[model samples]
Structure formats: structure tokens, C-alpha cells
Target: MKINNLKNLFKNNFVKNIFFVSSGTAIAQIIGTITYPIITRYYTPDEFGVFVTYSSIIAILSIISSLKYEFAIPIAESEEKAVNIVFLCVGILIIYSSIIFLALLLYSNEIFSLLGNEHLNQYWYLIPIGVSFIGIYSLFMYWSFRKKEYLAISKTTISQSFFGNISKIGFGFLNMGAFGLIFGDILGKSAGITVLSKSFINNKCFSKANLSEIIEQSKRYIKFPIYSAPSKLLNTLGVQLPVIFITLLYGSSVAGFFGLSHTIVSIPMSLIGTSVGNVFYGEAASIGRKNPKKIKELSNNLLKKLIAIGIIPLITLILFGPILFKFVFGSNWYQAGIYAQIIAFLVFFRFMFTPITNIFSVFERQKEELYLDSFRLVLVLIAFGISKYVNLDSFWAIGLYSLAMCIVYFVTYIYAQKILNDEIKKI
Candidate 1:
């Protein structure tokens, strides 16, 4: 009887889908994990700082490149509408990236000076290129999600990780400095586009998308741009702003340490949280319309499971984060481990809340997310302000930041539960 139950569990589609996605992410993260030690040896913290700052800029811009219309792809009512949304996203990406490139070309020095990292002025052109690649990859990845093409998505994840990491190591050997890290990242972002594009061509999705349909769908999903895009931009700001602040206040080496710690701590989030979140988003959207109560049940169960999964990592980091960083990354990165310990609480809560928060988009309750994310960003700024006011070191500033974010994410978890309850009551 137990064996039969186990076999049946394996046959379940949701479990199967998550397995495929998570396996790919697991392999990709493993490759990255193996290469980090080597990469760290070749590049200094200052170089890593520069790379992190450049990445932060790209990440913030990429959030709104399509005005977040790609988010509507999975929950779109029909294949035709979904395909049109993809074209809509790609079109917006081209225009947005072009604008960014032109702006940088004309105002590179002024912008870099404002950012307090004029070192980026030399590579200003790469900003738009990075944003474009990231935007394209995201839109297609969602299309894959809508089609239930988990295996294809998995292959692309592996391809991205393998090629990107290999190139980073190769460039490190050539002593290419921060530019190597930036270019390698751009290469990784581009690697998956070709494979994702095949799905579009094979399905004749390209021919189906027309300007009229694109405009119609854009209006149909206008809320995504109006509410979801800005909300997501603020959320990205909450995540990426610290790097800028650290760079401005403490310098590149400190930002590098912070960046490395963030990278290491976010591994579980990338590996499991994102994989499960993608699958959960697809599944929840399917189930949510028919049974709002089921969404509540599903979210509660996921929260419990996430808490269990996160506790071990949290405890491990608290106890031995610095030691582990010294041992695994290098002795020079000992400070990063200290930062990791400080932020582990935030990462843990983030891992739990992030996957489940798709309930907002699933139900079109983006305004609540916008409001909450606004508050979250404010809290982050307050943390930084307090740290700066008190003249604390980067370590203390990060601690205050983590503590503040933990409170907001916990509130977000509660609020998400309430959103689910409110939906259930409406039924």
C-alpha cells in the first residue's frame, strides 16, 4: 500500500512539473556553486562590486521593460491572447531598450556621476543590451510556463548556467576585470533566448500576433502595467537599492562583500523558491478562478512546508556562516559570511512569502501589492537612513535593513493570507 501511494504521488502532474523545473535549477545552481570559488580567486571584491552595481541597474530597468505585461501570459484567457501578449512584450522591450541606450549615450557621465560609480561610464552601452536580453528571456519563460513546457524551461536554465559560468571562468583567465563579469552575465542571459524562441516558431505563435491584437491585449491587461509594473519596480528597488547605497557610502569592496553574501544567501531562493513559485503560479491561477478557498488551503500548506525547508539553512547560517564562507569561498570573504548571517532571517521570510505572494497577481489584487511594496521600500530607506544617521558601519546598516525587511515581509505574509480570505468570503 505504501509503495502504491508513493508511485501515485510521483505520477501527480504538479509534483512532476516541479520536479522537472527544480531539477534543472538544482543542476544550474550546482554549476554556479562549483564555479564561485574559482571565480572569487580570480576577481577581487572591487571587481565584484562593479559587476553587482551594473547588474543592479540592469535588473531595475528589466523589471519594467515590457511594462510587466509578460506577467499576464500565464493567466491569459486563450492561447491567441497569450501569444499576442508575448509580441507586445517583445515590442515594448525593443523600444524601451533603445530609449535606455540613447539616454546613456547622451548622458553617460552625468548618470554615472549621480550613481556615485563613474567606473560604469566606460561600459554604459552594455546596460541596454543586458536589459533587452533579460526582458526577452522573461517573456518567453512565461510563455513556456503557460504551455506547461517545464522540461524545455529546465534545459534552458541548464544551458544558461553552464555557458555563463564557463565564460566567466574563461574571461577571468584572460584578466578581463569587471567587464569580463558583466559580459559573461550578458552571455548567460542570451543563451536561453534561442531555445525559448523555438517554441514560438513551432507553434506559429509569431504569425498569430498582430498589431491590433497586441494593442487590444495590452489594454485588456493594462492593470499589469498600471499597478503590477510599478509595484514590481519598487520591489526590485527594495532588493537592489542597498548595493547602490553601499557603493556610495562604503565603496566598491564593501559592496562586493555584500553582493557575494546576497548571492550565496539567495541560492536557495533561486533554486527552490523560484522553481516552486513558477509552478505554483501556473497551478494556482488554474485553480483560483474556480475555488478561491482552495487557494487558501494551497497557500497555507506551502507556507508550512517553506518554513520547514528554510529552518535548517537558517540555523546553519546563523551558527557557521562566517566559517563556511571562509572555508568555501576563501578567507578573504569572511566579512561576507558575517553579512550572510545578518540577512539569513530576511532570506528565510522572503523564501516563504515570495512564492505564495503570486496570490495577488493570480487574483488581480495588484494594488494591495503595490501599496505593501511601497511600504517595504520605505522601510528599506528608513533602515539605511537610520544607519547613516548613526554613522554605523556597513555591517550594522545591513542588519537594520534585514530587520526592517523581515517585519514587512511578515506583514506581507499576513496580508496575503487576508487577501486569500477576502476572496474566499466573496465566494
Candidate 2:
């Protein structure tokens, strides 16, 4: 009887949807984990650092690649309207990519010098290409969510993982260096987007989409381009700041160590939190539209589950982070394990908050989210600035940075909860 009841609970559409996405995420993460040890062995820390540095740049700029209009797709009132939004976003993305391409051509050398890495200059041209793929994939992903095509979304993730790793590992064997990792990332994104976009692309549904329709959709969702775009840019910079600062202040080696540590520790968040966030965004938007009173209950349940799921892994990392890193990734990554230990608390809260954080979007609270994200950016910058001026050791600097982020995440969570509570009560 108990087993039957549990099965029935899992049958709930929201729960089942989460399972579909998370199951694919789990498989993808597992594949990455299995292949990572080998990839690490083949690629040096400096090479990984170079790749990540470029990735950080792409991440910062990619925020506006689509003007973040992709975010509005899920909540748009109708599929036809959502299709127009996608076209508008893609139009912006093309113009954005062309602008970036020209900028890189003009200032690539100066930017490379500012980053304190000459090796990255060679990878400059790939930035626009990679960001284009990322932007397009994001559009397809949000469209998939809007349509509730969870299964297709899940399969694409797994396929992306499989194909991307194949290329990375294969290139490593060919001794391609950082180029291997960079291209792997791009190819993976291409594969995923191609899979998600087949139906929409084939039907040419947007061929009849007129400039006026695109303009109307753009204006209707202007909040995303204005508020959400800058907010997202700041948020990306905050997350990638550690990489940028570490590379500038210390060197690529330390940056690489930090990157590896962050990547490993974030597996659970990527695998579980991302899946939950996507599903939550869709379900919450639906609830907000039809039944506002249940928002608090949904938020509370999600919070409890996130906390429970995260506690054990975080505790284990705090206790045995270094040993785990050494055992899993090799002794060279021992320092990354230490870094992971310092950041575990922050990751726990971030993991718990990220999925539910979209509630701000569901409620059209982009202004509030923008404020919170800006505050986080300021705090992170201050943290790194103090460490730089004080000439602290890299370890202590990361500790300080980690501490700052943890506090910010906690505050953000509380703010979100209060806002959600107030909104629910009003409804």
C-alpha cells in the first residue's frame, strides 16, 4: 500500500517532469564524471585554465546574446506569441553576435593582455561562435519548457553529454590541447539545440512571423531585455568573477584549480537543481496564472526537499573534501578539494535557492531580482578587492570570497522567501 502511494505521488505531473529532466541530468553528469579523470590527465591545468577563462568571457557577454527574451517564452500566454518571442530573441542574437565578432577582432589583443593571459588570444575568434550556439540552445530549451516537451529535453541533454565528451576525449587523444575542450563545448551545444529545434525548424512555423509581430512581442517582454538582461549579466559576472580575479591576481594554474573544484562541487546543482528549476519555473508560472494561493505551499515543499537532498553531500565534502578530490581527480587536484571545502556551504545554499529563485520571474519581480543580483555582484567584488589590497594568500582569498558568497546567498534566499510569502498572502 505504501509503495503504491509513493508510486502515485511520483506520477504527479510536476514530480514526473522533474524526474524526466533530472534523470537525464544524472546520466549526463555520470558520463562527464567517468570521462573527466581521463580528460584531466590528458589536459594540463594551464590548458583547462585557458579554456575556462574564455568560457567566463563568453558567459559574461552571452547574457545579452538573446537579450534574455528567451526567459519570457515559458510565461507567454500562447504558443504563437512564444514563437514570435523566439524569433525576436534570435534576431537580437544575430546582431549581438556580429557586434561581438567585430569587437573581438578590434580588441582581442588588448583584452587578452588585460586578462593576464597571452595564450587566450588564439581562442578569441571562437567566442562569438560559441556564444551563438549557447544563445540558440537557450531559446530552444525555454521553448521546450513552454511546450512541456520534457522527454525531448531530457534526451537532448544526454545526447549533448555523450557527443561533447566523445569529442573532448577524442581530441585529447589527438593532443588537441585547450582547443579540444573549447570545440567540445560548442559541438555539444549544437547537438542539443539541433535536437530540440527540429520540429520548430522543420515546420518553418516562424516563416510567416512578421516584423510587426516580433516588435510587438519584444515590447511586451521588454522587461526581460531591460531588467532581466542586466540582472543576468551581473549574476553571470558574479559567478565567473572568481575565475577572472583568480586568473588576474594569481595565475592560470590557480584559476584552473578553482575551476575544477567548482565544477566538481557543482555537479549536484547542475544535475538536480537545474532540472528542478526548469520544472519549477513552468509549474509555478501555471500556478500563478490559475491558482495563486498554492505558491507558498509549493515554495515551502521545494525548500525542504532541496535542503534535505543537499545536506549529506555537503557534510561529506566539508569533512573529506581533499581526500575525495585526490581520489577522484588525482593528487594534483588536492588543492581544488580544499577550495571545494571552503565553498561547500555556499554551494549548499546556492543549490537550494537556484531552482526556487525563478519564482521572482514567475511573479514578474525582475526589478527586485535585479537589485539582489547587483548587491551580490558588489559584495563579491569587495571581497576580492580586499584580498588583493591586503596581499592575502590565494587560499585565504578564496576563503574570503567563499564566505562573502555564502552570506549573500543566504540573504537572497530569505529575501525571496519573504517576497514569495507576501505575494502568496496577497493572492
Candidate 3:
């Protein structure tokens, strides 16, 4: 009877939506988990380093590719308004990507040379292509979130993983090196576009998006471009800069090890954190105006659940990360496991706090988020700078980085709680 009651509780709409997204993310992660060992064997750490550098650049750029107006879609007032926001995001994405492409063409030599990775010069064109695909996918993703099409989103996740992983293996066999990894990623990102586009084309709401409406919505949500975009960009930079710094300072091989560790640690974030965040954002947006107290309740419940779900895996990694990495990804990757151990606690805090921090956006507190993200970036730079000053090894540098991030995430969690409490007080 107790088990049946628990099952019924899990069947609620919020839980069901999380299940749809998480199950899809789980399948996608499982595919990567199974293939990563093979991938590690096929690509040397140096190659992985180059791939990570390219990916980090793309990730930082993609954060603002649409100037973050797509984020307004889920919280927009009406279907018509949301549709216009999507169109606005698309227009901005095209212009932003084109600008990036032109800039790269004019300065590819200098950019690649500064990064100390001449290998990326030949593949510079793919950066803009990647930004476009990621930006478009994000626009569609938020639209699906608004419509509560979790199943469609899930399907796209699975398709992307399947195609992307298979392509990576194929390209690796061809010995295309980092280009193969980069191209495979591009393929994976593009794979789900057709599936996600169906929601837009089939809905009559899209036709409501006119030039005037787009302009109106753009101004209406002007804070997204003004504040949210920079916040998100800084957040991404805080995450991706380590990879770039490691590549520049310790060399690509060390960066590759760190990248692999970070990837493995981030699986839980991708699998559960993102799923919960999507559902939470959708639900919170709906309830934010009507019943703000419920947002507090929901956030508290999610924090507890995230803590319980994350503790065991993170603890296991901390204790046995090196062993697992060696056994799974081969002996050469043993160092990656050590890096994972150093960052496991950081990932735990991140996994617990990151999903719920969407409340910042939910409450339209983009400036606060921007401030926190700026603090995070400053801390990261200091951590790396201190490491270089002392000539600390990669492990110690990562440890310092991890400590800084843990502090920031904890502060973020407290701030989110304060925001929720303050919202309730206003009533």
C-alpha cells in the first residue's frame, strides 16, 4: 500500500514531466557512458584537448547567440507573445552567428595562435555553425517547454545522443582526430532540429508573430538582452574558462584529462539537474504570479530530492574515481579520475543548487544573477592566477577551482531561498 501510494505521488504532472525529460536524458547519458570508453581509446588526450577548446569557445558564444530572448519564451504572458519572442530569438541568432563567422574569418590566425591551438584554424568555420545550431535548438526547446511537450523534448534528446555518438565512433575510426569529435558534436546538435521544429510549424501561434509583435516583445523583455544575456555569458565563462586556461597553462593533454573528468562529473547535472530545472521553470512561471508561496514549497522539496539523489554517486566518485576511470576508460585516463575526485564535492553542490537557481529568472532578478555570475568569474580567475603564481600542478589548481565554485553555488542557493522568502513577504 505504501509503495502504491508513492507510485501515485510520482504520477503527478510535475513528476511525470520530470520523468519524461529525465528518462530521455538518462537514455542519452547511458549512450555516452557506454561509448566514452571506446572514444577515450580512439582519441588521444591531446586531441580531446583541442576538441574541448573548440567546444568551450562554441559554448561561451552560444550563450548569447540569441541574446537570451529565447529564455523569455517560457515565461511570456501568452502564446502569441511567446511566439514572437521565438521569432525574435531566431532573427538575433542569424545576425549573431553571421557576425561571429565574419570575425573569425578576419582574425582566425590571431585567435587560434593566442589559444596556442593552431589545429582549430582549419575548423574555424564550424564555430559559427555550432552556435547557430545550439541557438536554434534552444529556441525550440523553450517553446516545447511552454507547450509542456516534454515527450517531444525527450525524443529529441535521445535522437541527438544516438546520432552524435555513432558519428563520433565513425569519425574516430577514420582517424580524423579532433575534427572528428568537433564534427560529431555538430551533427548531434543538428539531429534534433527537425523534430523540435514540428511544434512551431504545426501550431497556429507562430503565424501570430509579425514584425510589430516581434519588436514589441523584444522591448517588452528587454531585460533579457540587457541583463540576462551577460549573466548567462559570465556563468558559461566561469564553467568553460577552466578548460581554456588548463589548455593554455598546463597544455592540451592535461586539459583533456580535466575535460574528461568534468564531463563525467557533469552527467548527473545533465541527466537530472537539467530535467528538474526545465520542469521547475515551467511550473514556477505558471505559479509565480498566482501563488508565490507555492514556489517556495516547490523549491524546498526539489532541493531535498536533489540532495538525496546526488549524494551516493558523488560520494562514490570521491572515493573511487581513479579506479573507475582506469577500469572503464583505460589506464591512460587514470589521471582524469583523480581530477574527478577533486571536483566531486563541487559537482554535488552544483547538482543540488543549479536547478533551483532558475528562481532568479523566475523572479526577473537578472541583475542579481549577473552579480553572482560576475563574482564567480572573478573567483575563477583568482584561483587560476594563484595556481600559476605558485606553479601549482593541475590537480591543485582544479582543487582550488572546485573550492571556489562550491562557495559560489552555496551562496547562490542561499540567495535563491532569500528571494523566495522575500517574494512571500511582499504578500
Question: Where does candidate 2 clash, by residue pair?
Answer: none
Checking candidate 1 for backbone clashes, the offending pairs are none
Against the reference, the lDDT scores of all candidates come to: 0.90, 0.86, 0.90
lDDT of 2: 0.86
**Tens digits of lDDT, candidate 2, 271-389:** 68888988999888777644556766776788899899999989999999999989988888888899999878778878888887887788778898899889989989998999999
Where in model 3 is the C-alpha error above 4 Å? none
Query: 1-427 in candidate 3: lDDT tens per residue?
Result: 9999989988888888989999999998899898888889889999999999999999999999999898899899888899889889989999999999999999999999998888899999999999999999999999898888889989999998888888889999999999999999999988888888797898766668799989999998999988999999999999999998998889999989999999888886646788889889988887765577998888899889998999899889989999999999999999999999998888888889988999888888999999999999999999999999999999899999999999999998899889888988888
User: In candidate 2, how many Å is residue 387 off?
Assistant: 0.7
lDDT of 3: 0.90
How displaced is residue 305 in candidate 3, in Å? 0.9
Least accurate 10 contiguous residues by lDDT in model 2: 288-297
Q: RMSDs, each prediction?
A: 1.2, 1.4, 1.1
Cα misplacement distance, residue 121 of candidate 3 (Å): 1.0
